[model samples]
Target chain A: MSIASHALWVACLGLPALAADRIEGPGLGSPVSAQSVAARNTSIYPDGRGLPEGRGSAGDGRLVYQQKCASCHGERGEGGSGGHLVGRGPLTGSDADKAVGNYWPSATTLFAFTRRAMPMDAPGSLSADDTYAVTAFLLYLNGIVGADEALDARSLPAVRMPNRDGFVWIDAVQPEKPR
Target chain B: MPPVNPSCRAIARCVQSGGAVRAFSVVLDCADTMISPDTQREHSAAVAAQEALSMERWSRSRLNADDQAPVAGGGLLDRRLFLKRGLVFSGAGALAWSSGAAGADQAALPSLRVPGRGFSNYGQPSEQEKRAIRWISANRAVPGNGVSWSPLHALEGIITPSGLHFERHHNGVPDIRIDAHRLLIHGMVERALTFSLADLARYPMRSQMLFVECGGNSNSGWNKEPLQSRAGYLHGLASCSEWAGVPLAVVLDEAGIDPAAKWLIAEGADAAAIHISIPLKKAMDDCMLALYQNGERIRPENGYPLRLIVPGWEGILSIKWLQRLEVAAEPVMARNETAKYTELLPSGKSRMFTFVMDAKSVITSPSPGDTLRSHGLYEVRGLAWSGRGRIRRVDVSADAGKTWAPAQLQEPVLPMCFTRFRIPWNWRGETAVLKSRAIDESGYVQPERDKLVAERGRNGYFHYNAIAAWQVDEDGEVTHVYR
Candidate 1:
């Protein structure tokens, strides 16, 4: 049989056996409460569907950084074991290993990253307000925002990154050299 | 399962659960009477103690020094003398102590179970195999400007575990959020278009089992002294996997590629914003916007949400965290293409864009560290692959390059994938060399070490496909050498 046909056959044979096994066998009980599981399953979409109701100011973010983040990220956000969050030089041409604040093209990515995986240990532990605060603080450190600037969902998307235009799509058929 | 005597069973099971051999007093008694004076003289105290109960006794008086003969036909000593084996059996006390020690060792071994933890949403490699990780050898100054080699020696089967796949990063691994990741296609296209990961997922997708090898792999082969490392460490940067994604043509069609546009510049989301210009024909032909690897979403170390998969091309071109594609009229002449990946030829000129990895083969088993026990029938096994096409043949040389024999190539030798080959070899006591050479479908044969050096010149650091030779001495020591 051809590889694809064999794979199909295996899948056909395996699915029923798996279904039967699951029905007949004792299953591992759900660990989390149903309501909590439902809440955790919420996924944010690109068209701004699942955005939470919260606002943060760059001034408030500076206080949050000093209180919680600065111990590891350094006072100026130059980074230590946690990585620098500010003062990025050139985003694309030649030297690219500066900092995330200047290089990242999307402010939405900053908020999303902080909301999902930050503080080294406890991932997904930050509130939406806290995530926005951290994003504002990081942007301020990169000289993208004023110390007292308020950052909300609308303002966050408008904050343009230095390397916003640095990237180009992968055109496989083209022969033009990279800029 | 009980362990049966290998000679008595039709099919011997090498792996057994318990000690099943019974102590035979009669066999032990017979073994004691068969040792010869010459045997005693040849075997030192340690060897004699180990063989006391097992070996056959020989008479010193009948054994002449000049003409030694076989015990069974009229060629050697008396048949009865050979039959009488040695019986210098170990005491019951010692046997009991040995068994007790064995039991203690078994008890000390850790159990493969968790105390409280249970199932996981995602799986990871076993803790015992943690050392089987990609050896990251990045530039010290730059956080992500370097390469990580796949631990090929520690892996089995064709698919490289996603976590251990090699990485060649121009910038650090970007923490890309799935929601924010957008692929933009602009420039010479009829209409500038942007695609979210969900939008790309809506398109029809195909999966391929292939290998991605860094062009600069085995560049150390140009070194004056042979590097002392495992075969995988020397050539582990290459890996094979099943990549699944949407066809590049579908996306290019959506963007409406203009006829004048010949080159496509691919850029990443990382800090470096690394870019590479590829031919438009190659992209529209077989390229893919890969989203899944090995039946799951691509790992963070790999291209998480999306990556450009250039089949059979250099790994660097398979840009991860793909962000943009700008259709252009001419080549971009990226830094990667000009400063790096360019091979300085023996002549003054240099060879650039040498993308496809040529045919290569290496013996993985019976390699450097593994040993052959008792010099009997042994199977020599290894893997061979080619980027140009399928591996047509793998020739194994046991007696150095003196004799070449075809090895059994495992079935389903897919193009641009690893093909396993094995051969049975009877290893005698004489010193010998082992090597393997692969010939691709295009009839491109792997060159010998000397031939490769002669053609490429001493300064050549890339595209090294020299035949690897392993020397085995009388004492069973295997070492790598240029033959």
Candidate 2:
């Protein structure tokens, strides 16, 4: 018999075949508690969804940036060891020159990335306020906002990135879509 | 697996130390003693002739016309004489040394007297093959965030040994206890569910040979100058293995994905908590929660208990130490997808989520760091692959791109897996350049270096899949060059 027909025959014999059209057999696992997901699943999307209530100004952020990020990102955010936080145009350049100011396409990414993973050494340690402060400081260094401008859940999403419209969602274009 | 015998180790050492002829002769002599006199007489003359042929001086440049004959396809070599095909064992012609001394005086060999040790629970490559290891390039400052390259040039066959599979870890590999680990599926799902490793194992499974390649693989090609390194080091960030797992779609269906869930935000348990957004369609199609690789439990460095395997997608999207997958309406804009992996297109705009790796091929043997010992005939062997689909053809050029020759594709060239292609070429002491370009089933040709550079520019350094060229000096030294 042909392989396809043999597979069909096997399926008919009540024997488990390789990959089913849909799920078969008893569904595995148990329902998870909503609290557990709420506690750990802390990811923020681009449209300001899942953001916590907090506020910080660029001036207030300078202190946090100095204490927590300066060691790696440089005191002035010019970048010493870790990636640069300030630069302009041509996101592609020397490793030190591809700063957040130039390359990053979304401002919300800064707040999300900072809140989730930042400080290089002690990630997930920053408070929501501290994360906002750092995000404001980075934006200030990029000249995206004034030093006194306050950034919060309502204000952060409105910040425009220099390269915000520069990106191309490659999945939607060119070569015939995924089969 | 049983303990490997010390004698077996000794035999391996003997074979590895250019004493294969002597070791094989001793083994044959021992066999001769056990066989009856009539049988020995029947094979004695044939064995003697084989031994004589083995001891005969041979040149690397010499090739039998019958074996090197060109086939019907453009520049394609005859497939009958492929060294990897139709492996057969003959008594007299035993221990075939494809191209090496066959016979030597076998007087002193310890393995002849001592019986080897028993097997062990797990096996390892013989001590002599220790050279086959992942070339690690980790950061001294960060320690764990780095990459290890698979030694592709040293390996044979299409399947890369699980131990030697390339690695690109963001945070040091997490020591996740299988029993303690639980994968949480929540967010836009109708029901939030957490499954233990055992629970996932209860589901139906499928195994397929697929390749996982880091998005940054072959970035060295973007360097202003071509890098001089082994073929594996330059492009070894990709590896192929047989992964066995439960289709992710089934698990998602169990969770009942919300129609609004357009993306799946996968997070790892690593210190970095590396997370990225994968399209919901891709997740529901052909993606799997891989629990095993190469017929065994996945290696610790390669996502121990569970990993999300998105076939043909960037390796990073195949998150290791998978902890939670949150269905979302859009991308998380994670650091990996923004500051890194994203490319700065020459159009002055950045390109994000350029997920699929394009068609590419590399001549593994006679590559940089390999020297042509003699001017005789050599089989130009290499691997060709395309994230889009199976490689339809791999055209190899011996004298740069002036002329092209088709290579014989090995059987079972599955989609998105490494297809070993080879063509025999005769070198006559001339300084020749070698190149191979892969054409996938979609008719997408691997771009040339100049064409790629002209389009992408040298400022960006990701997803570089241009044709690689190796130059052979008159003295037989091979090195990398951007032609």
State each model's CA lDDT, in order: 0.62, 0.74
Two-chain DockQ for model 2 = 0.26
TM-score, one value per model: 0.58, 0.83
Question: For candidate 1, lDDT tens digit of each residue in A13-94?
Answer: 8754433111111111112333542343222322333457787877777777787666556777765334456746543232
The lDDT, on a scale of 0 to 1, for candidate 1 is: 0.62
lDDT, residue B308, candidate 2? 93
Q: Which segments of model 1 are wrong by more than 4 Å?
A: A1-179, B1-117
Model 1's CAPRI class? incorrect
Interface C-alpha RMSD per candidate, 1 decimal: 20.8, 12.2
Deviation in Å, model 1, residue A135 alpha carbon:
34
